[model samples]
Target: MKVRITIMPQAAVLDPAGVATAHALEHLGLHGVSSLRIGKLIELDIEGATEEELHQACRDLLSNPVMEDYCLEVIS
Candidate 1:
């Protein structure tokens, strides 16, 4: 099975990297780019794991609950 994990900053957390990227885009003449939030995507292959198992793995190790949120999707 293939597992995709998207890790993003929480809504209440500050994203300085995203802010910097937005500013850079504006500097490069890329207008109309309002708010931008940066995150990470982790793709991996799991052998003999169910959807429930993947979700549990995400909650337990892949994401930080304090300032991060994650979503898991199976692609296979």
Candidate 2:
């Protein structure tokens, strides 16, 4: 099966890197954008797994539940 994980920082956390990139874009003449948030996408291909295993992957290793949120999509 193929799964895609989308991980993003919680609104309460400070995203320094995202802020820096937003500023860089402003320097490049890109304007009118008020905010920016950077996140990560992790795609995995696992053979024969149960639903519980998929959830465990994200909880145990793929993401940090403390500061980030994740959504799992099974592609195939």
Candidate 3:
């Protein structure tokens, strides 16, 4: 199966990179932006991992539970 994982910093966490990007966008004349955030995507092809195992990997290795949130999707 093919999977896509999206990971992002939790709202309560301060994201320096995201802030920088927002500033850059403002500089480029994109106005009226109320909020912005930065995140990452991971795509993988696996042989035999269960959904529960994938979620466990996300919690234990892919993302920091205290500071980040993640969503896993099976694409194919």
Candidate 4:
């Protein structure tokens, strides 16, 4: 099976990198983008792991629960 994990900062957390990227985009004349966020995408191919295991991996290793949120998807 193929899985995708997306990890991003929580809404209330300040994202310095995202803010910097947004500023850069404005400088390049790409206006009207009010907000931008930086996130991480992790793709994995596994043989027989259950969804629970994958979720545990995400919570423990892939993302910081204190500051980040995550979404897990089964691709195939």
lDDT of each: 0.90, 0.90, 0.94, 0.96
lDDT of 3 by residue, 1-76 (tens): 9999999999999988888888898999998777788988999999899999999999999998999999999999
Instruction: Quote the positional error of residue 38 for candidate 2 in Å.
Output: 1.3
TM-score of each: 0.90, 0.92, 0.95, 0.97
TM-score of 4: 0.97
Positional deviation of 6 in candidate 1, in angstroms?
0.9
**Residue 71 in candidate 2, Cα distance off native in Å:** 0.8
lDDT of residue 59 for candidate 3: 98
**Candidate 1 lDDT, 7-47, residue by residue in tens:** 99998999999999999999999999978999899999879
Query: What lDDT tens digits, residue by residue, belong to model 2 across residues 1-76?
Result: 8999999998899999999999999999999778899999999888989878988988888888998888999998
Candidate 1: which pairs clash?
A: none
Candidate 2 local distance difference test against the native: 0.90
In model 1, which runs have C-alpha deviations exceeding 4 angstroms?
none
Better candidate by TM-score, 1 or 2: 2
- The root-mean-square deviation over C-alpha atoms between each candidate and the true structure, in angstroms, is 1.1, 1.0, 0.7, 0.5
Tens digits of per-residue lDDT, candidate 4, 1-76, equal 9999999999999999999999999999999888999999999999889999999999999999999999999999
